[model samples]
Target: MKQQTKTSKNPWVWIPTLYFAEGIPYVIVMTVSVIMYKRFGLSNTDIALYTSWLYLPWVIKPFWSPFVDILKTKRWWIVLMQLFIGAGLAGIALTLPTPFYFKASLAFFWLLAFSSATHDIAADGFYMLALDDSQQSFFVGIRSTFYRLAMITGQGLLIILAGALEIMTGSDPMYVNVTTSPTEQVDYNFENIPEDLSNIDELTFVVYPKNVTINTNKISTDSLSSLKEFAREHNTKNGFIALSETEKLKKNRLDGGETWWSHNISTPLANAIVKNFGVKKEVITKTTDDKVGNAKLVAVRLNKQPEEDKEIVLNTGFAKGDKSISIGSGERLVFNSMNWNVPAYILVQLDPKLEGVTSASFKGISGNIPLAWSITFFIMAGFFILIFVYHRFVLPRPASDHGSAANSPSDILHEFGITFVSFFKKRGIFIAILFMLLYRLGEALLVKLSSPFLLDIKEFGGLGLTTGEVGFVYGTVGVISLTVGGILGGIAVNKKGLKYWLWPMVLAITLPNLAYLYLSTYMPESMILINTAVALEQFGYGFGFTAYMMYMIYFSEGKHKTAHYAICTGFMALGMMLPGMVAGWIQELIGYQHFFILVILCAIPTFLVIPFLKVDPDFGKKDK
Candidate 1:
């Protein structure tokens, strides 16, 4: 009784920190890790498939939710889970410098995923136990606010931090500039390649064919494809070789279930879908005798070797330049101990209708990637440790924060059986479960690949935004929009109820996906446009997501509300996990444009399931 009194504090005192801690690990596992792997040169296929599997712990968290209840107090679970999450983060930092960093870091991420899943169970359960029904309803918006803030921190601030750290720990950025003149007969291709490079403190870029000439006078419109193909054939970019077409189709042991399923089932199905509904890309304009783009070979090499024992990665792409004269290939390439001296050829292609002198530039930023990522994770680990310490003291301990009346192991199991049965036995539970499962299916798919699409070079049908830029777009502006939508959603639902706002929120979430379609088709460089799109989309998602959560809480209102809500979340995670696991594979098979189209098409299921959902007229209404 004394302990409970001492621990009791205002809900405002702890909800922010509690939910903030709850959100950090989930975002780190699900979102930030995708960007980290992309920076480290992991393929989209691997990043999506592997990271999507991290959702498994949450999918099956309900299986262990009862165990969480039967074993210890919610406070004990929350504190312990935080410590485990911190340990997992530290483990990732430790493993990043190792040779098997990929596998080792994945192991640690698994630890984070599981610990975070368990933490969600505890923290969410504790929220209900510590507050009365009215208090729970009132502070719901506050908790969600903090969680989204965590998303901003992880998705935006954390990524910006890593990107900044990348520059600090690595050499100064190297620029590969080009000037094109159609009238000039200048060619600066390397006559002889250097066999060895001397070590230097600074790295500078040298692009041969310093003056490019593209005579685009009266060529066939079809020449552009041929021009691009010529660049591809001439590119002998050394250091890394991509998988052959057949190799990408074949299954590997590392991929496990996702690979097998993708190969035998999803591939054929996807091919069929693409052949039918897929948008056909045009190789040439209708004009028969229009001037066509021409491709030029630009051999690139560093002025000096990178620092010894550190593998410096040079990520180069359009950093504000003439849109016509763009990199046809080799936007991002790595340089290391073995290949520092060997020159890699980049295909610089000119846009059709070029007849005069014009110049453009691409910038490459080099960084000690392993070290940068390690330091980033190290900082995250330290943050969790600090939060763990803070919550250990500040979290309120209510008198009702114990397990069910069952005091022994046998009694706990009996209670678990009863709780599980009651949850499934709830009125219209099948519809509730379906609503939970299908509500966020589209988001599950989109969320997984959004980062990859942002980081991928423009040449490969992506936005090619810098890591820091992606962070700000999604984290700051997007999160702010989402938070506003969510807050408004809670208040609106309080006034009008879920039934009144369901269809509007549905449109809110699904309609903004068109922003990606527009982005992929146009590939705009304006940050304002990009942020606006993201903000609208995130706002809709955050708003729509409030309805989903309220429905879960509404459905789980019962004798076993805590355990029942866990089951609902389990389904919620399942909705995200299954689709996210295959998002990358699909994107690779098709491209970002079609992949997004498919994501939009997926919204049909959400709409279909929603009409069938049963809701109370006064479920979320605030009492006077």
Candidate 2:
């Protein structure tokens, strides 16, 4: 008779809880780190460098995994790690400041990474201890499905939530315009201004100055009069005039060869003239030829210095004042008061070089309907496609049926023991670890150095993307491309053996890094180019990463396969961390362009790993 065996009362009970614990902390640390850095106003290089340090706990987790196995039960480790992660997240939320939320958030993320790494070790070990070979075989699919769902929840849902919060609160966009000089000049051209203002009824004028002062009648007039009289004796026409309507005499008078007085007086001495004079007019004429027949004539009073041979023409639009005067050809009007009437539009023409001056319209996202809708539709369609592929193709296949051999309690234990011992003995295990360590070196370097290089206004190292724009490109477009690349890579690997596709994977990965080189070199002002470059690089990374995972699986063969794979992942984390720690310092030393070149140079070691990898002959073969 067959031996009676005790089984889990409910196999699926722990699925959601375990996966949720696994996913949240990992996503918060690994994926959201980029967003946090961007929010904190760090350059790409700085963010990459700093956050990459967070990978340290993950990289060294393998060294600790064995101890977990030897020491207390897996359940204890899992529960404890989960609690730790929750605490870390809560701590981060508490520490986050209104101003520096991103940096504080990242601090908590690092804590989460540490906790999550420990959780991963215990959870994986617990799976082995809890399930027999047959149950393990059947349930592995369930576990992976939940794990993927967790990734989607963490990366997709959480990231989207963060983005929505960023947009609503204006947190990301706040850092865009950096503090610089008090006045940052941007050129504007008045090309659309009507050239011919020949015909019109009432011309309204408004004048504004770069700097303005309001001289209220606050000071005593006697003191001002005495100072002005003294200045006039010194040939300086500066003084205050005080006269009531009854005290002032209105008549045609000339003092400086220009029109000095007018007969028609609206208010006595209200508009008085002193010495300097100028005139500008917007004339309306009745022309039978065209419906909009009108012109604006701008007149000027040429002020010539008597002692010097220089002539300075002070135009009607020169000193800020407004007047509506009707003038025929060669008609002249004079004012006795010092107040000169200038047209409003002449303010922009004061300096010949100041040609560009125009107000900009604020049309929101909805204004660009087609482009916005196109992007929205594309993103939605991509997500749907992913859902379909994941559910229809990837979900149905069980690990045991697809090259995983251990299928019963005895088989799992035997395999585990053999693999566990082989992990210490085999040269391949060490090599695999080394390969994982080297795999992400280039990516790490790129992240660590790209921002400082691009933002170096002094030197040519970066594209100088705005904070919001960079977030859009990297967080949104980059994420999409990464998803697509991962999906494609998975499909490719599943269809063709990793050995046959090694060179293509290498090329795909390395070539995309070159996009960064190009982008860093020609830091384009256009948002489209920036988004495209980010997408391409991320897509390549996604594709290459799929190959890396497959290689780990291939290397983790024989006994204790899951443990070996976990060990490899630790090295992978290390590869990211080591480069990140030194990225900022290196960027400061070598600069951005050269640093990116160095990133490219690091790829050589990654490609070198490809030659040593042995592809499984029956890589994609199904078990009968």
Candidate 3:
């Protein structure tokens, strides 16, 4: 007894392992299962329906609680159940990919649920048995805290790891050795032109002498003709004109015919004519030394020639007649007719050394040599550390007070046999079952129907909320309200006893459910109001659920208390399961507003159950 006292004194020793065992499977089934199904592209309704079934083991847990009580020490049940849970996790990790993996995974999860539920029973019973009432009171907070931590570890850490792994190993494209080069180059010359043309049109021509060698293959006559026509229309009689080869030799002749000498032609010429006449002016045309390099051209009116005019010239590798020059809206230039009306073409040559330039490519982590090694090393280290810690420290610690809990093999079989038989014989079990089934009928119905109804959009009776916003309202506000309601309900029950608090619990639970009716029918546009109402309903549920849990405890007071409690939980599970199973189909039939009305109507049964719950007059009274 003294040894038992010492072992129980350090309840912390058992909690981490026990809660860790409870938390991992719960997280896998409840949170990770949903996420995994989503990742695999399962629909919301399917995920909801399938995942909701995972809650079954928890609901039915109370039925098997007695075997742990009567046959073996709670400590034995704890270690064995932990082993079962670990195996179930291993099974899920391995079998999740099979063709029938969903069903198989469900099977494993059901096993895990049973293991987890049994663990909960043992852990809770052991907690009560190991400690005196005072110790139990003092350490309740510790147990709850550890359980929450376990939840965080299971839900948070494992998901992060899985996500990271998926990112690292996932498929991504790869690039190979490739190269690039500049294709061609053309140079031009500039000389023997009037400087006055600079102000007239700002035409910067780089011309080559007519005798310069050229690449006929590189020049297109069709392109050059288009430019010549444009230039002729813009050029005036005072501006330079393309002279015929015969006219080039006829020196000093530049009135209406082409001449070899550069001329500042600003007036209209006989052949030149404007087509789409709007504004007439010479424009500045800046040419790049290399045609391939970036160039600039600006438009300005041509007036007259300047005295100090610099000689205009053009040079290009293309033949005199095989070039293309573009004219601005109001600009033009002239040259000897022997010289083609085409301007010199410039091309910037690419260096041979720099020809191999290639684009930068990103090959994801898998193809990245450095990252692959890093990830491999990191995973290895993490794997070893986890294994060492789990086996060395966590696995050896007995869940119950008995040191031989893990080693004693037959203990589980015996406990299972007893739990199996007593489940059928418990007393007040029927009433407890009925109460559990009826208590939260309205809540289950509302939860099952609300999202589908709300998703329909206002025209169809839904609030038309976006997925993210809905998740936020339901997850954050709803969770907070649930906590608040539970706390308040616990406080109210402690103050007034079960009988007095029963009516309020019923009201709290039932009335908040009406908020859904308001939300569905009115289809409120204000997010704040909708969210507030959601929080309010959640608060009511939290408060009211406290009464429900307490009543279960009250009803489980006789010979097979654990077994009776399990039976009650099974009915509770049934209550939720029945409503949730067909909720989607029902929503399809009735729509949001009508479905919510059905939920409100279901509350009537919960309200009717209030009279049957007895309150202990001395419940809140204390002994000195």
The top-ranked prediction according to lDDT is 1
Please report the TM-score between candidate 2 and the true structure: 0.54
Please rank every candidate by lDDT, starting with the best: 1, 3, 2
Note the Cα lDDT for every prediction shown: 0.79, 0.50, 0.51
How far does residue 16 in candidate 2 sit from its true spot (Å)?
4.9
Give the poorly placed runs of model 2, Cα more than 4 Å off.
Answer: 1-17, 41-50, 70-76, 98-110, 126-421, 428-434, 448-476, 525-528, 620-624
User: Candidate 1: TM-score?
Assistant: 0.89
Residues 174-217, model 2: lDDT tens digits: 00011112134333233433443434332211112222221111
Give the TM-scores of the predictions, in the order they appear.
0.89, 0.54, 0.53
Candidate 3 weakest lDDT stretch, 10 residues: 314-323
Weakest ten-residue segment in model 2 by summed lDDT = 171-180
In terms of TM-score, the best-performing candidate is 1
- Candidates 2 and 3 compared by lDDT, better number: 3
Q: Candidate 3: where is the Cα deviation over 4 Å?
A: 5-10, 13-17, 20-24, 27-49, 59-63, 66-101, 129-133, 148-432, 448-476, 522-527, 617-624
* Candidate 3, 1-624: lDDT as tens digits: 222453223656555555555555665666556555533333344655777787787776665454566567666676677667666666665554444556776787788778777777877766666665776678776776566555555444544454455444432322111112234233333433323444535322322221222222222333333444444433323243333222232433454454433333412221121212211232322224222212112112212332232222111111112112111111212233322233322221122123333321111111111222234324423443353345334332234344334545587667656764675565555565667888888777676545444433332345644333444565456655666677677777777777677787778888888888888757676779998888888888888888788887776666656666666677777788777665543443345566677777888776666666555765532320
Worst 10 residues of 1 by lDDT: 240-249
> Which digits, one per residue and each the tens of the lDDT, describe model 1 over residues 501-615?
8888888788888888888988888888988888888888888888888989989998888778878888998888888887777777677898899989988988888888888
lDDT of model 3 at residue 519?
84
